[model samples]
Target: MNRDEVIAATRQWIEKAVIGLNLCPFAKSVYVKNQVRIVVSEAKHVDAFLEDLDRELEFLAAADPQDVDTTLLVHPTLFPDFLDFNEIAGIAEEAVVEHELEGILQVASFHPRFQFEDTAEDDIANFTNRSPFPTLHLLREDSIERAVAAYPEAESIYERNIETMTKLGLDGWKALGIPGMGGEKK
Candidate 1:
């Protein structure tokens, strides 16, 4: 898919799986407020993607939270393997610090093959973090803190998501029409 197509798919997944399923209690608030920025990266290589990430970090740091509270950098073709994506994800965190955004921002990763440790590859819990494409969700620390404080039992989100996905199961996920999550696991 092209950049726009990829971004559209990412948005669909967010609307359907994340918000529709209520995986994140805080997402709907910012999302409906138009505070979410989705940027589709045209970077074909890892280094190129990092460069794009640098610019995005600068943009998020400079923009007012009311205008853009968070960003989702949707990268379509760079890291197909979960291990490779996980490795580059570290560098993404480092970039935030390099941009002097430490403690101000953080990166949450989502991928087509997102897998939880100690779980089978096809485990339903993995779907909780799965997205149509490899994405870096840049969020403001203060906003997260506020949301967490207001939310009851925020620590139970993970377990709650697992429960949600387990209820949906793989067949249900496929029914959501998210790309890269079709047919049986290879």
Candidate 2:
């Protein structure tokens, strides 16, 4: 897909899956305010992708949160496989620490086939992290702190999501109409 198509699809997924499902609870505000920046990476290799990631991190660091509160580096071609992306996820996190932006910036990952440890690959719960593409969600920790503080019982979000997914089941998730998310081959 071209950049525009990639961005369109990503936005649709955000609207339908993330906001529609109320996964993060904080996503809609920044997204609606246009503080969310989406960049489609054309990197074909892991090394190149890392470079792209570094550049994005720097960009986010240099940017004003009011102008760019968060960013999504969408990589549709690189690391198409979940494991490959998952394996490299560590490096991504390390970049944050390496930059000494540990408490300032954080990375939230999503992939077409996102699976968790010990869970069955087809587990419906994996949908929590699944997105239309292997994308990196770079967020400002201060924003997250504010959101969590304002949210009562924020700690229960995860458990609530698991319960929700369990109640929704795989079939229900598939029915949501968000393309490229839900069910198996995790």
Candidate 3:
């Protein structure tokens, strides 16, 4: 199915089944491609939450396998304070391989306030303005190698993204800070 169709179907499932179950209080939710990411503030009860989500997904799969895939990324709020984009990308790659998923579904969770120390508000704004998180990237594995080989533009985009993140660092810091300004006084 096309990306838009996949997203629309996933949204319907969330509204109908997920919301009704009260599985978790969604702090933020995004659907792209065929993936759905739901972030909740209170993640202490992730097991119970995933249990319910799994059940709903089962129903969805039975009814419409095209809409819901077996692979899911469950990111509990207590994950870590220092996870970076490459780390997350690696996790996604691992998930795809481990689950034998046709596509990926990623859920990322972390403390909302963590950004204050980890990233500049301006940097965050700039990053989000350029590329928003919880974005849906449609990848057809069967054709990915061929597509990449054929598409120079795709390779360019990938390289640029890596370069940008490297320049910014995972924490977006040239150096640690004093009280107000970034970077400690030497």
Candidate 4:
């Protein structure tokens, strides 16, 4: 798909995932890196964003499932180059950070191709330590609570992942290929 199409599709997928998991609007924005940085915003509109993501992932997966594994490390934060990592970090609460990190790690671990170490500390540290690269930011209001209320299962999964990551150590996290500051991929 073209860049515009890819952006649109990514938004859709994000919407579906949120609706499917019943997540709340805790924050907005996602970052990813391609040949260059691309930022996809307007994520406050959960439905629209998720729809776009769903389509994009489906297209990529259909083209080649291996692409998913290869590109997962591309860094979603590299999209929109306008935002700052510290700014995004400021907007996020400990709970939200824990939740997202856990969910992503779980997904990565379960994927057939990626070999995510079963070390939560390692994963969390690697993710949190990532360099600030502005990409897509979802503008959320009070949607996160709604999502949690609607999708209890997804919430549980997120919680489990957070707990697991918390147990891992900084050294372990460094072992993972998580990015450092300034979008430096390790």
Better of 3 and 4 by TM-score: 3
Tens digits of lDDT, candidate 3, 1-186: 334443443344344323322222221122233433322223255355444334433333343323433233223233332235334444544544454443433323222122324556444322321211122122334334444566556646434543554565535532322111232221
- Whole-model lDDT per candidate: 0.89, 0.87, 0.34, 0.32
Which candidate gets the maximum TM-score versus the true structure? 1
Q: What number of backbone clashes does candidate 3 have, counting pairs of residues 3 or more apart or in separate chains?
A: 0
User: Per-residue alpha-carbon lDDT of model 2 for 79-155, expressed as tens digits?
Assistant: 77888898778799999999888999999899988888999878878888888889999988999999999999999
lDDT tens digits, residue span 1-186, model 1: 887788778878888989999999999999999999999998878889999999999999889999999999988888889889998889999998899999999999998888888998899999899888889999999999999999999999999999999999888988988666552442
Prediction 4 TM-score vs. true: 0.27
TM-score of each: 0.96, 0.94, 0.30, 0.27
Q: Which ten residues in a row have the lowest lDDT in candidate 4?
A: 105-114
Give the clash count for each candidate: 0, 0, 0, 53
In model 1, the runs with Cα more than 4 Å from the true position are 183-186
Q: Tens digits of per-residue lDDT for model 4 on 1-186?
A: 244544544443333322222222321222221211233433444345444444433333334322232112122332333223333323333323444432221111111111124643235523322322233222222333444566546546556544544564444443442233222332
* Candidate 1 accuracy as TM-score: 0.96
Model 4 ranges off by over 4 Å: 1-84, 88-133, 153-157, 162-186
- Highest lDDT among the candidates is held by which one? 1
lDDT of 3 at 63: 38
Instruction: Name the candidate, 1 or 3, with the larger lDDT value.
Output: 1
